[model samples]
Target: MTMPIILPRQEAPVAAIATPVGVGALAVLRISGEGVFDIAQKVFRKKNNPNFRFTASKGFRAHFGTVHDSEGLIDEVVALVFRSPNSFTMEDMVEFTCHGGPVVVQHILKVLLDEGCRLAEPGEFTRRAFLNGRIDLLQAEAIGEMIHARTESAFRTAVTQMQGTLSLRLDAMRELLLRSCALLELELDFSEEDVEFQSRTQLQEELAGLQEELHRLVDSYQHGRLLKEGVATVIAGLPNAGKSTLLNVLLGEERSIVSHMPGTTRDYIEECFLYEKTMFRLTDTAGLREGGEEVEHEGIRRSFKKISEADLLVYLLDISLESYLDEVPLIRDLLERNSNARMIVAANKIDLATGSEERLQKLRAATGCEVCALSAAKGEGLEALKRLMSTMVEGLDKLHEASVLVTSLRHYEALRNASDALANAQELITRQAETELIAFELRSALDYVGEITGKVVSEEIVNLIFEQFCIGK
Candidate 1:
């Protein structure tokens, strides 16, 4: 729960349009830092209450008012008041709710600046919240995630993070690391006296247990990624295997051109499809074949790249064709290339006479994986196919139910580094190495974990994290 040792930042009162810049009913302009209320009062005139002073107003109170500039009579507004140490940045804050027209927002923001408020930088508000210890770096990033979240699942996860659930978990882990690091440092201090602050046996046990926990958190990244950025699913097969057809059906739109001719889809078409709580970034790839034209080759190359990066691979097959089993080798190749991606062999065109249960059994036998039989054209048995798609990412729902998940790649990488450092410390301890060596490794692990929650991080990394956020946030 301790604050990070971040650099001191300016306490200048800053202002910015806190809402999206557009024509809307209302636009909110946020101002935070020292002396914000005084700056706001200069631009805002309380309606029929000239005697009302923002300085005299209670925190969280609002005053109906009109804003003005040197030009005069800028716009009618409602001034929201939040006092120092009780606001977002733990500083005096005020928000002007004015007409949402871009011009009005600009005018109001300009008047505030003219009143001595500096323009807020991108994410400066949230940055202040972090710098002032109102929220951790992880929680700050979570706020950005919540704002940009497209799916309900992603939004829910971000909400949990913003609520400091993950922060609490990381803080617990940090406490453990800090305790061990402190003990090791104590051992180093009394090296001359040969005093052991901690037993090597117990230390090794704790390191092993901590490392295991780190590994567990690291493993959650995949499911956590699925929550944050939908599953990268590629629908792949030989030409005319109904890859595009399946995509069109799943998306309920003719997103890709369907043709009897091969290589009709010379490029990949990507769309987002939400099934239950999980989102599938369905990519219909260019049909795979040997010796296609140069242009097709480039498309094929891109297709393979997408396939390689896929989290879920759906190998669609036109089971009605005599050469349908000929696709078996292609499916096997895809499985080999994308071994990390969960796969489903979709036996398409089951409405055709030859599309039979026995053919699906043969596919299952050849691929050593279950086959989903369906007709993308007729849209038959697609519910089962959709269910199979969900099954490929099984445990996703349960993962969503879990409180803690490492959705951010930044967090995952930090955890991985921490785990590596802990492993090194384990080796050093087992080797009966000098206390200083073990302590160094433990500190490295400690800092790595601290980076996630902003306990120990550089100014550059802090800037980089906030840079991704929009100005208002």
Candidate 2:
């Protein structure tokens, strides 16, 4: 057995509001530590009693009050107290429900700050919740995810994580690992007696199962990241395809300049939309057309560059035009360049077209991409387009269930490295290499899994994780 690593000890006071700072009905300010209530009482005042003893209050009880400074009353507020070990941070926590004006919130926070509390860093509140044993690292991350989730489906997955679904699954895997480690340690103890703690077949089976589970989790990162972040979609087509109008209708706002002139949009425009619980960043780029002005031609060049990075390409066709000359060749060339990118052939301006079903059929038959007939100007057939986009992004549910989707690039890289090490170790095992080499591979694989939940992480890695968070998470 290896000696456990001793982590650095750094305890500090932290305070921040649990709600957004705005002119609303109320804002919740949370302070957690050994002496949070006493700090609150120093500045808090009740109408009937000039002095209120905040620390003496029973747990979870609310106290009506007006917060004050030396000059005058700052704002009317209600305070809720939670005692140690029973609170979110397992420390004495005080919550202030004050009027939600920015000035009022700042003043209240100032009071706490003056009383020796430090400004909470982004995710500090949840970090404390994690350190205090109320939740694990996964749940801590889930809290942040739930706070920022854009769509209902994304929110639901975060909620599932918060409910311990992910933690429970990880815990099961950890248990198996712990058992295997214990059995390996026992082999060292009984090696002189030539007694087997676990048979070779049993060890192989256990390793295979553990490897399978790790790969599944590593795979889930793909779907998880898609749900967490969003898909980048690029809109490409000839000028006057109503791509701008399509972008506006999908976003429910006129975020882009809409004009009938060809090459009106000379730069890429971006907007975000949610469809079927998934988020998508829609990039409306300059129309791909020949013989444009130099500036417009440069814009078209950048549009193709953006198309290369896109997860999906939406090819718009203006059916009202006399002929779709530019698109047929442009799309064929794009497909040749990016064979893996999902492409959708959308026949725009369907409402204005003159019996364009034949044109739509011709376009669809030529490209062999997913096709949708719609009018971006009239908001026609948009729901169908949205549904198709969701399907393309999520893929078939059956595939997701059958294989693990790697969501985070961090997790994916780690898994790939771990898999490589495992394969090396397996080859060495077949060659009857020394026990130390096999053990090294096992430990390396374990450390890779730990990176996902931040176990045994370095200070630099922790800093990287926290840096990704917003200031007031």
Candidate 3:
């Protein structure tokens, strides 16, 4: 059984500008804690009702009011009240929706702070919600993902996670593991009787099911990570091989400086584009060549680094150049170094090449990789290139439809550890190891799964997770 999270008492009310800072039609400032209504009463007065008492206002009620300071009225606003135990932070909460002028919002915040509300720390609101049992760690992280989502697919994935899809799956896995652990412990207690609470065959069957579920979640981390962080794609090749042009064409704008001169691009230029609902971070790396200026060499160094880190490498080859095949060795070395990175040989400058198809075949035969012909300058065969890239990330579209996908590195690591522990337990059961040994492995697996749902986590881990969130989230 997991111990309940014990949160430290909050002695003061916390307030922050919940909305993005800047001038807009309206800006929302949030305040939450005990006696929040009293703090609001000091600054807010309902319009046309000077004697209106904020403390008497019901939860979820909104009142048209004007905020004032010692000098005069600061801003005519609408104040929303959310009483304790039902609010986002499960505390007495007040939200002032005021005109979104930098001066107006700041003045309102100044008055609240003067009235004894402390400025909220980064992610403090969300942190409170988690500590108050409103949401789990996985859901909290999903909220962050939703906020930073750059693509429709990413948004959908985060939304699904926030809706408790992943939580439900994990909870089910935990319950199964807990039952198995209880049975194993019972066997340990009754060891002198030589009785098995759970038969070996039954335990094996249960473990097989648990392992399958764990493996499914573990397998999802790769695709889920891709959805969370866009695919890192490196566009690399010889100098003036149209790597920058391809980037510009892919982005549908002149994002990179494209010149006919060799070694024009000294460093990598990165940009993101949505291809088939998936985000691809395309990086135009410095052309790889022997002996250039010092800066070019540094750029070449960075290119190799990017290639090694890339999820996909677009190895562009200038078909117009006679030494196109000379890059075969470089491509092979890159492939050997980054065995996981998918490679695509792009025969660029096809418009200026003779027998482009023959060259494409030769490049494919030489590299043993998929090759395509394209003219980045004229935007020829760009669709085919995009289609191929999309195909590489094709399965991610189905991930959005999944009931659960482990998207966080932390959750992935926890699930991996739990899976390993369960594997150990399964082996122990097979070998008829001591009941205490089997129970130890089972307990280890349970603790790992508990970490995912924030049931058995340290304060340090919780703080680190919430620290990534923006203030007032």
Candidate 4:
């Protein structure tokens, strides 16, 4: 097996409050790198053994001591130690677990900083883990996403990726490609012997199978990306509609200002909500109108711009103004321009309008768009709306498909480039082009695919990837 590349050490002192810094039962300050134990021991005094030497202690051990400064004993804490090469960063590491309080945590961190330990940069710890062979670039990215997971779906997706399902699949594909490359090389050397290392028909069959699998994974990203990042949903309607009320009820908060005044919301207001396992960003936009204040008109313009960019648009209609249902021409134009977006007709104020049920059926039949009748103010019929949003994202049929998905845009882009290159390679092979030309196209395809899993990525890309992570990762 070939050894993977390990990043060169750009060593620096690093320390952070491993535990949150708020008032809690306990907090931990972690320090790792050269002289970790020695520097910690200088400030830590054990009640039992005042002269306790931590640097001389055996690796993978723990000790109890009181952290003292010139002001005397600061706090009694436990220190866990890990020796070099066996630790997370492949450097000596010490964890100081102390009582959780703003003052105590701050004082402990101050002592370590004063003792020559610098504060860790965002994701410095995990970056070290990547450099030390503790995990691969894909796993490192998974860890970062896992930390920021906001919904059950996002959490599960990140966990699945971090657990190595995606990694295992990628590794298997790479192994198959490597085997094919080796056979091709062998055929080049023993052409006169007429030995068939990999028959043309067999190779083509395997290639076809791999390509189909890759396409399936690539297709999955549409839903996977939505699950990870949430869909941009813009709620739009006429003046005095319950768009704001519906947004607050769905988010369970007063995220958008509500009032009886027409065009009250002159600008877009957004908030995120969790519906079952998925996340949806609901934006209550300015009510559509022809004549209004200059500012209100600008808001309407911005609202239209948002509608164009939205993944889903909620065309809200105030049932109380059922007479305005004939004004659907404006909405028809909006939909015509944004033909790619999924539009759902929302009949708001059902509690006030007695004719809403008939109006909803008529609108749905005439516009050929999904319709839901719900009273936003009374919080009635919201469940059906949530279900519709989920369905529009990806039909219920694909909901329970295997959890493995390509969620990274970087991976999606790489797969697309590789797929195009493979198509070209197949064409070349079919023409019986020079062997060297086929090999060159195959090599290009391989390189493009390698970018997806960091098999052939630059150090700059790795740094940018880590930059997205938080500290203490």
Candidate 5:
């Protein structure tokens, strides 16, 4: 790995609330830097030990004390000490645990500031951890992901990444690429001697192997995206087909307005639904029909846009009417246009429809996809629909068990670029290209992989990544 980034920051000791900013039973304020213990000693007085001093305190030791300043005592607190090279930032740090209240916390913070502690910036503490060699860049990003995770799957994936599962794999890849580049460079330096450190055919085999592995990592991005962000599932059909009702049933809330009049829902509504471990971003789109008002036309345009981008399309049909069967051709058109998207046919209003089973059979035979019969209004057949939805994305659970998965778009793009460079190197090897040419390609690939783990990254890119975090992280 390359050396840690050296970004310019203020030299003063930094302090910020370690917990969420709200009234709670307790709150923690952390400060870290050189002379941090000295600063803590200025405002803290040990409860029983009158001679207790932070500078003389051992690491990981906690002292019951009252934090007082020029104005007097702010609050009674527990001061936990972490000596240099042991804390989160790998610096001398102290965390003050006090009663959680806006006013109380603010008073303590003001006292710390008055005693010479600068407020911490957004993500500054984690950035210090990275600069001080406590965690890598990927792990830093994973920490942010863990904080903002919305689903259980997302949380688990983030936790795995933060624990170094993905970093270890990328580091191994870097070693292999670096080894090949060194060999190729040595060959270039001794061109006149006609010396070969390794045979060209053997080098080609190594490059081909790396290329295959890179391809696997690049291809896994799609599955990783589904884990990081929920699947985009769109609900679509003609007006008055109980689309709104189905959306409400799936969400277990009356989120959309149900109506009998066609074109009542001229816009789209979206919500999240979690089945098993998978999350679905369910969107109830405006009904598709022939042209109507200008506003309706725009809504239809947007509905098609959503359908085109969906991972799962639920085409609802009112099986009560024989005319519903006539909509098959439209379904075929949608499938044709979006052949990449998985589809399911939902025959609705079975409670009031005659010969519903026969209609469902016909629909099943016609659509060539998963078909389910349900009465959205009465909330029947919901279990089957949910089970089918879960089965639609069946293999994601296996991905969770894999050693490493790429869930960040930045990582995905970098992997793709690195894989493409390796591909080029492979072709050059097959044709017995110059050693310098191969070495250059190998070096490029190495750098790209390093960028993902912050081994060879720019300060601007680093700032952009850490800026996404909230303050006190």
Candidate 6:
């Protein structure tokens, strides 16, 4: 009989204050690992039974207790116990619900530390969960996303990811690839016999379908990233173009210092607001013009940089100004420079202009982009602008409908690599390349797919993924 090989545990017993540090009704301190009950036994005293054994306590049971140091009692608390192999991290875990206070929580932590519990590093708890097979790297990242989510859509997307929506899809793709690779391996094994486990045509068709699926996932990264990190929408134009006013109106608050004076906004001001469940990071940039003071020139330089980096540009043109046509050349130059960025030409000060339709139409023709006529000062036509903004982000409507999306750059890159490898394998089959070469490419594709679900990931990559997590997660 062969003996089972036991992998050595990589982590020590750890403890941390799980709750935010401040005056609250209650605070939770978490402890997990082997011998956690022994550590709990030393610090926690049962309210009714002084001689109670923590190790013998039933798993998932809560006990009223008091935490005491060597000198005396630290805080009256409730201890929740979770036994090994069933709890998060698959280790004996305990959580103490103590009165919320800085002094009390600190003393409780100190007692646990003195009793041999090491303080948990940032993201250590979630890292342990990943290491112990409770959650994969994608779920771990989803946890972080849920924590930092700024919009309802972002939160929902994170929750879906945490529930393994993306994982299930990746797993299915990997299984298919594994089956295909297995057939290739069989052919390799019987090279002399020239037996075909699966026909080359069949393999090619299957790989083509998998590649198409991967292509869709890879294509989702742009909108996924935009949803994750709010869209970088820059409001830019010449000075006194109502850029700041537009920002203030959109936010429904006086976030920026709006003034009639030229060059009042010497730098950029940014704020995020949700519209149609999508978060738009609106930036009010300094006026773009030539021949300004040194500081103004620097500000103008920064405004151009913002324009270049923006996902969408809201170029505000003061319709009342005769020099608006002069500004047309500058806008054309900017559009040429940032060809990838989406543009919405806003003909501002429409309330002040008489018969602005002809000019608006000319503006639309000149820029050859979506144009909106609005009075930022009077808050007119803002609703239409908002609607347009919501429509700008592709697939916003399908966000809730889609079961899986490629949100992480890591996942996107892995999928692209897998797709490329599978494509190479398909080409090799068409050319009747060596079975060994085809098998090698298929194996490469399989490894890339495995990396997404953490089935074949390196320790360094795992650590890096979890490092984004907060302590006591």
Question: What does each candidate score in C-alpha RMSD?
Answer: 3.5, 4.6, 3.6, 3.8, 3.4, 3.4
Off by over 4 Å in 6: 1-10, 189-195, 252-270, 290-309, 329-341, 350-358, 375-384, 394-401
Tens-place lDDT per residue, model 5, 70-96, is 878889999999987778888889999
TM-score of each: 0.90, 0.83, 0.90, 0.86, 0.90, 0.88
TM-score pick, better of 2 and 3: 3
User: How well does candidate 3 match the true structure in TM-score terms?
Assistant: 0.90
Candidate 6, residues 1-473: lDDT per residue as tens digits? 99985542646799999999899999999998878899999998998798899888889999997998888988899999987766777778999999999889999998998989999988888888888877888898899899989887678889999999888888899899899889889888899999889898888889899998898888777667777888889999989999999999999999999888989899899999888777899999999878989999999999999999888889998998766667778888888878868888898999998879988888877778799999999999999998887787654435424456777889989999999999899899999998889999999999999998899999888888877777888
Superposed Cα deviation of residue 312, candidate 5 (Å): 2.0
Give me the runs in candidate 5 sitting further than 4 Å from their true place.
1-11, 192-194, 264-268, 293-295, 395-401
Candidate 1 residues 70-103, lDDT tens each?
A: 7789888888988767788877889888888999
**Candidate 3 lDDT tens digits, 316-359:** 98988888898999999999879878888899889898877778
Winner on TM-score between 4 and 6 is 6
Instruction: Compare the candidates by TM-score and give the number of the best one.
Output: 5
Ranking by TM-score: 5, 3, 1, 6, 4, 2
Cα lDDT tens digits for candidate 2, 286-331 = 9887898899989998998888878788989887777764467778
Question: Each candidate: what lDDT?
Answer: 0.87, 0.75, 0.88, 0.80, 0.87, 0.87
Which residue pairs in candidate 3 have backbone atoms (N, alpha carbon, C) closer than 3 angstroms, thus clashing?
none
Instruction: Tell me how candidate 2 scores on lDDT.
Output: 0.75
Which TM-score value belongs to model 5?
0.90
After superposing candidate 2 on the true structure, give the runs of residues whose Cα lies further than 4 Å from its correct spot. 1-10, 46-52, 178-198, 258-267, 276-278, 289-311, 320-326, 336-341, 350-355, 390-398, 402-417, 468-473
